[model samples]
Target: MPSRARLKPRKMPTQQRSKATVEAILAAAAQVFRRHGYAATTTDRIAQRAGVSVGSLYQYFPNKDAILVTLAERHIDAGFALVRLLLREALAETPPLAAMLRRFVLAMIVLHEHEPELHRVLFEEAPLPSHVRRRLRERENELASEVSRLLEAHPEACVRSPDVTAYVIVHTVDSLVHSFVLHPPKDIDADMMTNEAVRMLLRHLTAEGS
Candidate 1:
C-alpha cells in the first residue's frame, strides 16, 4: 500500500541532457514493462535497460511505480490528443452520425495498432495506480464531453439524452474497437466490424421514442 506521494518523481528534469535521460528511461521502461509486466518489473531492471545508473533513475522517479505511472500518463495523453483532433474534424464537417463514428472508430483502431502490446501492458493487464486510473477516467470524460457536443451538432443524431448517449458512444466505441482489434474473435473482418459498429450507433442515436 504505497502512498501517491511515494509514486511522484523526486525531481523534474530541467536541463536538455536530463530531459534526454528521462526520455531514455521512459523508452526503456516501456520495453521492460512490456517484457516483464508490472508486478515483476523493478527499478534496477529499468535502469539497466535504459543504460543508466540506478541512482540516475531514482533522480527522476521515486520508484518503479513512478515510471509506470508516468508511462501510463503519456499513453493517456496521446489517446486524448487523438480525441481532440477527431473532435475538431467532426465539428468542421458535421458529417452524418455514422460517417463521424466511422472516422473515430478507424482513427482509434490505428492508434491501438501502433502500440497494441504496450497498450495492453499499461492499460489491459497491469494494476494501475488510483491516481493514474483517475487521470484516465478524466480524459475519457473529456472525450465523452466532445462526443456530446458532436451529437448536439449532428443533424441526424436525435437521442433524448445527449450526455448519457455520449458516454455510451465513447465506451462502446473504445471497448469494442480495443477488443476487436487487439483480440479478434474468430474470423472477424475489420470492414464488416466497422460497418456494424457504425450501424449500431446510428440506430441508437436516431431511434425514435426510446
Candidate 2:
C-alpha cells in the first residue's frame, strides 16, 4: 500500500475554471465516498459523478486520499466560518454565557445535520492522511485560541486558566455533539441533549474562580 505522505492534492486551483472544477470534484467525492465507502471508492467513480473526465480529476487530485482530504478540509472550513462568526458577533451580544454556548452548540449540530452521512464517512471511516489529521487538530486549536481570548475579555468568565478551559470546551462540545447527534440514543431528544451540553459548560465556567 502507498504511504500517507503521497495523499496531499497535487496543486491548488488558481483560476476561476480550475476552482469550479475542484469544487465539483470535491462535491462529487463526498457523495461517492459516502455511498460506496472509502476503501471501495475510486477516482474514476468520482470523475464520472463530477461529470468530468478522469484526466480532469487527476489534474487536481493525485489519488483518492487527496480527494478525501480536500473534502475534509471543505467541511472543516465551514465549521471554522461558524466559529469566526460567533467570535465576531455572538461574543459582543449582551446574552448570558449559557445563551452564547447554546448558540455555538446549535450551529455545530446544524453543520452535522446538513450532511450526516458524508460527515460519518470523512471523519470516522476514511483513512485520513497525517497532514489531514494534523489539519483537524490545528483547526481545533485555532478555535480554542479564539474562545480563550473571548473568555479573558468577558467579565463573567471565572476560570483562571482561559487556555486550558478553552481546550476542554472545544473538545467536549465537539465530541458530545458528534456522538449524540449522529448516533443519538433512542430515548433522548436532540434539543434536550444540546441544552444539557450548554448547561454543562456554563456551570463549570461560571462558578467563582473556577
Candidate 3:
C-alpha cells in the first residue's frame, strides 16, 4: 500500500461531492431563475450550468422548488447582514435621533442599490417552502428587534412603540428602495431616491409627530 499521505486519501465520494455540487447547482439555478424566470428554469439546465452531474443535483436538492428555498435562505441571510451593518454603524455614531436614523436608512438603501439582484431575490420573490419561510420570518423579526433595541436606548429619540416602529421603519425603507431595485423609476435618480428614503425614515422616526 502507498504511504497514507501520498495515497490520495480516498477522494470524497459522490455523496460529499454532492453537497458542494448542490451549492454550485443552486447558485446556477438562482441565476437561471433570475435570468429566465422560475417557470422556465429546469434542473437539467441548472446542473449543466453548474458543471455538475444531474444525479449530483438530485442527491442534494430534490427539485427546483427545493433549490429556490435554498436561494431564498441565502438572500435572507445576506439581507439581514446588510441591515445589521447599517444598524451597527449608525448606532455607533453620536446621536441626534433624526440624523442617525437618516444615516442608517441611507446606508441601507445604498446597500440595496449596490446589489439589487440579491435584494430582489430576497424581497420580491414569492413564497418559499414552509421551513425556509419560517426561518426567514424569524430572521426578519430578529433584525427588527435589534433595531428596536438600538432605538430604545435613546429614549430622547421619542420613538413611539419602538418595536412596532422599528418594524414599520425597516419594512417601509426596504419597500421604498426595493422599488428602485425592482423598477428603476425613469424620473427619479437613484441618489435622489436614496436621499428621499432617508428623509422619509428620519421624518417618521425622529420628526415631531402630529
Candidate 4:
C-alpha cells in the first residue's frame, strides 16, 4: 500500500486543457482498472488509454494510487449527489413512503448496474487510501444524519429512535442494493429486488405496534 502522501495528487488541474487531461486520465483509468483488475493494471496502460504521455499523467497524479483515490472520490461524490437529488424530489412531492423507498432503491441499483465491473475493482480489488476510507465513513454519517431529519419530519415514520433507525436504513439499503446489483442472484432481477427491499423496509419502519 502507498503512503498517504504518495496517494495524493501532485497538482490540481486549473486550466481548461489540464482539467480535460485530468478527466481523460481518470476516465481511462476507470476503464483500465475494469478490464485489467487492480493488480494487473499499470500506469503505462492508463496513460496510453488516455492518449496522454507518462509525464503528462504524472503532472496531475503522483502515481496509480493517486488516480485510484481520485476515481474513488468521484464515485463517492456522485453517489451522494444522486442520493441528495432523490431526497429533494421526495421531499418536494412528499410521496408515500413506499414510493420514496422504491425511487431510492431503484436509483441505487441502476447506478451500480451502470458499471459493476469497474465498481468491483475500485471497491473490492484495490486498496483504498486511508483518507478515502475516512471520507466514505464521514459521508455515510452525513447521509444518515440527513435521513434522520427526514424521518423525524415524516408523520408515518413511528420508529422510536429516528437517528438510529435512519442510520440502519441508510446502511441497510446501501449494502443490500450494492450486493444485489454487483452479485445478483440468477433468479432475482432488478424489479424483484427493488420490490422486496422496499417491502422489507416499509414493514420494518411502518410495522404495526412499532
Per-candidate TM-scores read 0.93, 0.88, 0.79, 0.93
Q: What lDDT does the true structure give each of the candidates?
A: 0.84, 0.82, 0.68, 0.84
- In terms of lDDT, the best-performing candidate is 1
lDDT of 3 by residue, 156-186 (tens): 6566588898888777776776677678888
Compared with the true structure, what per-residue lDDT tens digits does model 1 show for residues 58-170?
89998988888888898988978886787778879988777888887787787677567778888777778888989988988988898888888876777888889888888
Models ranked on lDDT = 1, 4, 2, 3
Consecutive 10-residue window with the lowest summed lDDT within model 4:
106-115
RMSD of every candidate to native, in Å, equals 1.6, 2.2, 8.7, 1.6
Task: Give the 10-residue window scoring lowest on summed lDDT in candidate 2.
Answer: 1-10
Order by TM-score, highest first: 4, 1, 2, 3
Q: What alpha-carbon RMSD in Å does predicted model 2 have with respect to the real structure?
A: 2.2
**Candidate 1 segments whose C-alpha is farther than 4 A from its true place:** none
| Candidate 4: tens digits of C-alpha lDDT, residues 153-181 | 67787788888998898889889988887
Can you tell me which runs of candidate 2 are displaced by over 4 Å?
1-5, 11-18, 208-210
Q: Tens-digit lDDT track for model 2 on 99-161?
A: 777877886677677678888888888877677788889988988887787777677879988
Q: Which stretches of candidate 4 lie over 4 Å from their true place?
A: none
